[model samples]
Every structure is written in C-alpha cells, then in structure tokens.
Target: MLNRERYRGRLIDHIGLVVRDFAASKAFYTAVFKALNIPIGGSDERNLWADELFISTSDSDEVEGHLTGRIHLAFQAQDRAMVDAFYRAAMAQGGRDNGAPGERSYHPGYYAAFVLDPDGNNIEAVFRGASERSAAAVRIRY
Candidate 1:
C-alpha cells in the first residue's frame, strides 16, 4: 500500500496547463476556480522553469500538436457538500459536467465530482471517506 503520510504530505502545490491562448486559458481557469471558491495559487507570464506551462497560441494551434486530448487534475474538497458545491460552481462557470458527486465503489467511499475545463482538461473535486449513509451513522461530516 502507498504510504499514507507520504501521499498526504505531498500535497498538490500547483498544476500547470498548456494552452493555445494563455489569456483565455487563464480567464477560464480563473472563472472556474472562482466559482468553485478555490483560491488562486499563482500564475505568471514569464515562467520558463515550470514543467507545465500555459502559453499563448492561436485558435488553430493544437495541444502538443494534437487537436485535442485530456490532462487530469484534481482538487481537495473539505467534504461531500463541498464536492457538490464545486460541481455546481464549475458548471456555472462554463465547465462541462463530466461526473456528479457520488460514492465511487472503486475507491470505497470516494466522493467526487468531475468537469472538463475550458481547455478540455479533466478537473475533479474529491473527498475520501465513507458514503453519506455510513458517514452519517458515525457522524462524520468533516
């Protein structure tokens, strides 16, 4: 099994996106995050040392030379309610709904919501714990 502390310790400091238009991508991400109530981590126009960068390009430009593809990214949710809220917020911000908040059997009580960012990147908000039923039984909301 994975080391729980190590996994939890390596919190996602940031995420990088490569887009055709930096401004548009930034705007889209900003709006989506705002709606979800996630604070802006950081951004820059002169970031050259980053592994993933969102650079300005033309409409005809392709991601990594391909017309379209997906990059997976996820955010931590405080609880199941926050996951639901994030899903609604993302949809309100022009994100396409990919999945609704629910328990994932694969993860054994993993609750999450998913959406496609403006650049087609897969974004998710996840909460790990028992399902609402079980959680309620134990009075676990946080």
Candidate 2:
C-alpha cells in the first residue's frame, strides 16, 4: 500500500471515478502505481480498485453522471525518486504530462509530480520530504 496512515480522517476512505476508457486508464494507473509501489487491490470486467481509489467505465450507473469533469488525486511517494519514477512510467503508459517532477511551493519540502490520466483527470505523486510522524495512523474502533 502507499502509506494510508497519512490521511487519517482528513481524506475520505475511498473515492471512485468513471473513466472514458477503462483499458487505457487501467494501463496508465498500473504503470504509475508500479512506480509508487502500490498494488491493484482488485478488479473485474467493469472496474478496478486499489487501496482508496476506484475506477470504472463512464457508462456505469453509479458514476455516469459524474464523468463530465476532471478530478484530482494525489498518491503518496516514499521519496523524491519515486515521484520522478511515477512521472516517467505514467507518461510511458499513455498518461499526459501535466507537471514534471519537481519541488512545489505548496510547502517547504513538498516535492511532487503530476500527469493527466486517460480521462484527463489530474493524477499526482508527492513526497513531503524526510519527516517523523507521531503515529502511522489514527484508527477508529467500535
């Protein structure tokens, strides 16, 4: 997995996107995810999912209505090198270059890369640089 602990309660546990072409999207994600060291959690004819992201055909009933606009998704990178690898692999697998790998002014050490998926959604891989965390995650138990 891509270190789910950083999200905690700030981001939703999961999100789904309806892509114009499932095959292209699948290829693009698979290549880039390989660079980031995340696995394909599961998939079938209609959709694919990994960790917190879900992708399916635009005609699918659940996501058909939301396929018009682009979406932004950022994946965590363990280091700056992974961000660069993600950009290269993504572009090699039909992803369009949105932003090259570099440090962003979003914060002092926010290094990241961006690309446009087959559906034109903004996909990113980012590393916050070396830092320590008090805890890997904040889990809720009933």
Candidate 3:
C-alpha cells in the first residue's frame, strides 16, 4: 500500500492553471500550500501539483500556451488560525493581501482571508466553523 487517500466527489476533479512565469508561481504556491498543510504531490520543470490543483508553465502541453484569466479559488482551512497562517505565508511569498483574515456575512461563521497570487489570481482560505464529517476521505492503496 502506498497509503494514499483522496476525498472523492469534489466539485472539481482537477484544475490546471497556466502561468506566465512558472518559477515565480511555483515559489508562491509552494509556500501557500505549505501553510495550508497540503503536500506537493509531484512536480517537474513544467508542472507542479498539490491535490486537485495543477499549475504549469504556459508552454506545457496541458496548458497549450494559454494563460488563464484571473480567477478566485478558495481552499478549506481547518480553523481560523490556519486561515491566518495562510495569509501570513502568502504575504511572505509575494502574495498581495486582497482581504485580511476576518468573518464575513456569507454565513454564520464564514471566516476567510484572501490574497492575490503571483499571477494576480484571487486565492482565499476559509474556515466554515465547526462541522461534522463522516470520514476523512476515501482511502486508496497501491
């Protein structure tokens, strides 16, 4: 067993973002994902991935030389403190603060922080307060 586990039934199976500069984007994302406690699943000169997100240089075959427009992507944080950590790490890695960590009216306990990635994509970390889960995720072994 490789001890692999993944949360299936997500809205998106995967998403690829083509960036103008892979090196810069890679550095920024590396720090950001670290704060989120997500591992860098794999990488090469052209692409790096963490979980469902794949980032690559525009020249990559999957990207087809097309750079994606600025988009908002929100990651789930386990708690409020993690959201703050995410903001701090992002800022340290050249991420611009779009919004500081705070609660919003989106729901009763929607705590979130936003930052613009190196490519100016809006990235957010949010904690939806305490909740229940049936299981951590679907486990797969290889």
Give the candidates in order of TM-score, highest first. Answer: 3, 2, 1
Q: What TM-score would every model get versus the actual structure?
A: 0.59, 0.83, 0.91
Which candidate, 1 or 2, would have the higher lDDT against the true structure? Answer: 2
Write candidate 2's Cα lDDT for 1-142 as tens digits: 2233323454577789887788888889889889999878767766777766878886665456457478899998999999999999999998899999999999999999999999899999999989887775565443
How would you encode candidate 3's per-residue C-alpha lDDT over 12-117 as one tens digit per residue? 8878889988888899899889998988877889998877788998888766858899989999999999999999999999999999999999999999999999
Off by over 4 Å in 3: 1-7, 140-142
Locate the minimum summed-lDDT window of 10 residues in model 2.
1-10
State candidate 2's TM-score. Answer: 0.83
Candidate 2 lDDT (Cα, 0 to 1): 0.83
lDDT of 1 by residue, 32-91 (tens): 566455555345562211112233333423224433358877766668888898788777
Write out the backbone clash pairs for model 3.
none
